[model samples]
Target: MKKWKLGMIVAAAALSVVALAGCTAGKSSSGADDKNVTMWVHFSKEDPEGKAMVQNITAFNKENKKGYKATVQYIPRSGSGGGYEDKINAALNSNSLPDVLTLDGPNTAAYADSKIIQPLGKYITKKSDILPSIIDQGTYKGKLYAVGYSESGVGFYYNKKMFKDAGITEAELPTLDKPWTWDQFNAILKKLTEKYQGPAIDMQLSDHSEMAIYSLAPFVWSAGGNITNKAGTKAVGYFDSAATQSAFKEIQDMVKNGYTTISPKQKGFQTGKYAMLMSGSWTIQELDKQYKDISYGILPYPVSPKTKKLVSPTGSWQYAMSASTTKTAASGALIDFLSAKAQMYRTSMANTVLPARKSVSDEMMSKVTEPMRFLIKQNQESGHARPVLVKYPQVSRTFAETVTKATYYKENPDISALMKKQAQEIQQYLK
Candidate 1:
């Protein structure tokens, strides 16, 4: 479960577009107008994680001893009213939203901006212990709107055999402290292209929908460019900046020089056709499960040689409360119970995720293997959350479409003109 495969439609915030689904539920028989604390999530009790959450909720309701028990409604995550965005929209329209709900990190701003959810800054019990990026992902316009129990990350998954065959030594590749510079990375990819029978790198174009923007963001940021201005009001100079253009040129060089392919012989890195894969840490599980003999290494994402700055994509699901809810106290209690250090650790370990809290991540990484440690270090040091703005959907989509269109079928694209067009389109959503 890529868990949060970000294939969302880039709809303007004012347009009311929702992507992804949660679960499905009918009104429980607690009396139609029951005022018990209520919550909604994207998961169901059918799974272990869901079951565990239910147990937690039950214990919390009983332990609080306030007679303010909570009920949860599950919405089908793949359907119209149940999909993440659709369900939230439906709930908003009918004013039937639960007192507490979950949101993806990037979507927190949209909800906060639209006044759909209220700030929960005071409820955060371990602000300093949590990953800085997690807090950043939940903050918008200077307010904390959400909190996440778990987190995910992207990394460079490489084939050890391919690297060895290319005459590349492990010491020469990217390390946590000293990752490959653009020139060094480019030179390696060139050599890797010759050794790799399939594609030099599995950029995973099939993931062009979300991965295109999410995973590729580090490059732009490392070069000191961004998808939007700090205020999130526009994208004029940020997306079209010289730093971004330079990153695009390197991407162009890789393509022009035959370092990648539109159609790789094999779609998977485990198949040994690709030398490197710019993918999520989930690939570790996939590797452990299959292709036992394939030697692989996980590397930190490369930085811009020009800026020499390091960065990596960071964000995941978060918890938020309804603005209209009268049960702020009860809702806050639920958030605390669900995101407690132990709870966060349980979910992170179960889902193979990096904990959003530094302490929890430290504990879990102590029990996990390989890339988890690497991911933990990187998440602490260089994790950069996407733009947390109401205009993020627009900005993200624009960056994805603009940058992808710039490089997809053509090389040496007029990146400046394309970015300007992107900036113009983005300004429409500023209001």
Candidate 2:
């Protein structure tokens, strides 16, 4: 969401928010038994993803394994406008956190650091089956605190018709074996801008929360810089590094050269307002469904000009148990059941997300649609989770706000100075 969106959520959530509603009896109701494991899942019950999960839980409950009764408490899409964070914080403070819950990819660290969730590694033994990036997304300070059943990935999507019109051949486009260097990519953006009267690429710059962090961090990664250092301790040299500066400079250049606007366009690529886009795999489904007339192609993220490395973003929603929940056995059982190979395939297939487990992903490749298979393959090979740090929220918000500030004005930011300021701000939140 955009900062305004988040701001509205936080401000409104300050009054009343529905973090969890309906059958939230997981917090040890009067007659609740040990078999009652409840989940506070964020998906709207009206959506297909939510409906499918509810159905899965219903089926699981039908089994009555050990007489367990699994239930779901629908968490609103955006609670009181603060989104998930505010709702969750309220729930935690009220001592009403659900026994099992789902968290976005980058939030594991925040919740773990706050002691809202517990380490889950001991509950599952088949961690090897899960993608390393998926595991990394859920880990905090070396301990696994969460695990996702499915994954999400991002790629550079292009308008094939625009490419053809610009005299760009398939060979010129970056391939997995040969991603475009930063220079090559900038040159192409320039060409696209000159050839197309509209934007060259859709940065989706308007939304500044998860979208900002998920899409932009990879560029920093490709440049061999990070939101935080390797030890996950500091952002000083990393966020303010020369490589990181160079990366953002290119982004600023794209804006300065009229290749992309500082704000997201309304269906820019789909409507031919933009020639390219950096988007999630789910976009393929949206395009196919909402804009079947448009011809588009997907490619790996551009590599760093200096490092020649590709780091594609990966992480979606994952389930984590509440640290204070007493029903470990039942809650763990529900989590394991959710992440089971068959269940992963089922839910991921229904949701169009990549399965986290290799076995489930392979099965999906063989059985799911071509686009789904393609995304699964990319996720398996090139996926990289966001920096799992306790202060990820601050880091993400700072970097996003910095990027926006850099592009908001006609003049670009002083890279080192702005980055240092951002790094310093993030440093203050390290403890």
Candidate 3:
């Protein structure tokens, strides 16, 4: 991954300390004498779903009659890790980490490697029914250290009205069973561009050239190429291979040929300007609010022309217990509660994220709207999580940067040179 500018890293590190200091003022509910279990959560307390989670925790506390109660501290939603990383790092340095906390997928491995988090192996025995992929995402160095709360994946969001106006039927929109291949996807984009006078597609990468790499991950993975190897010690070399080059060239052609537009100020997919976009299931809530009349649906990202199978990037949030916590049983119990059958069901009701448990997801599918049901099904079958590694964030950033430079540079954007540089950087870091 690309290295952050020294200044940005220093600034983020400094801000993190201040953020943690600010959070220390909040009073704990577990009482001064009673052992307290603190939770670091990323969700905004002001959001209705976040409020519901607080209410649920309260209800759980009352019903369980556990002597110890928990207190949640909200992390600000700025910087990478949504400001939670800084708080976590501060807590780690001071050895004051909360009993439990939420972790981004990539960060889980890093924290686990640092030995600041406890492995959840014992706690997970009873919850063995959780999906293997979800469980795997929280594992690092052969130990299960975190429990996933929700699972998300990237997919294509198309405007149904645009399809209809183009005389493209619902049958034409790619589905799980009938996913679109690169050639087919390109054809569809071409058709949409020809039929619609507005912006055909919005890629949302204009300023930070590296940002497009995240948007193109599905394509790379679908093509059986990856930004990095499984072990995460080196960058993948296939990025400049003929197949991968052709795949990226298609994206460039889409932009240059008017089939796609790269914009910084564009609105969501619900707007008529773009017929389709690459996004995760998290957008369902906003889409429901913004485009009630337009029929929109999601499908797994199209497969690469070189590879026939569709692949989608896994996006998830994990719950982990802090190593410093004295109340292991209490914190473990809370993790169990979150992963329990009934509470897992609440994951869907309260936060639109897919449950970590398949059973809960099955039930959630039955209750949620049609579009969301499709999203859940796609997420279950095709989602691919980011690899767990200590240097994942850095690796991800590097990969994003390399792809962006290749796509936006005026002169020859030597993909081979970029890949070699990335590999050397990762190798040095690992050593």
- Candidate number of the best lDDT: 2
The true-versus-predicted C-alpha distance at residue 329 of model 1, in Å, is 0.4
Tell me the deviation in Å of residue 36 in model 3. 4.2
lDDT of each: 0.76, 0.81, 0.70
lDDT, residue 16, model 1? 43
Using lDDT as the measure, name the better of candidate 1 and candidate 3: 1
Candidate 3 lDDT tens digits, 25-59: 44332335444577888877877557766876786
- Give the better candidate number (2 or 3) by TM-score: 2
Q: Write the per-residue lDDT of candidate 1 for residues 1-431, one digit (tens) a residue.
A: 34344333233332342322222332322344434778888876675557667777777777765566788876546633247668777767666677898887778887897898999988778688888888888888788889978877888888888788889997788787888888888788888876654357877654446567788888889999877788777677777789877776666666667776545556467777788888787778788878777787788888898788889888888888889887787788788778888778777877787788888876877699877788878877899988887766666777667656655646436766766777788777775
Question: Which portions of model 3 show Cα errors greater than 4 Å?
Answer: 1-36, 63-68, 79-83, 125-128, 197-199, 207-215, 236-247, 413-431
The 10 consecutive residues of candidate 2 with the worst lDDT sum are 22-31
Q: Is candidate 1 or candidate 2 better by lDDT?
A: 2
**Backbone clash numbers for all candidates listed:** 12, 3, 6
TM-scores, one per candidate: 0.87, 0.88, 0.83
Model 1 / residue 248 / CA error / Å: 2.1
lDDT (tens digit, per residue) of candidate 2 on 343-407: 78878888888889999987877777666666777788888998887777777888888788667
Per-residue error at 38 for model 1, in Å?
1.2
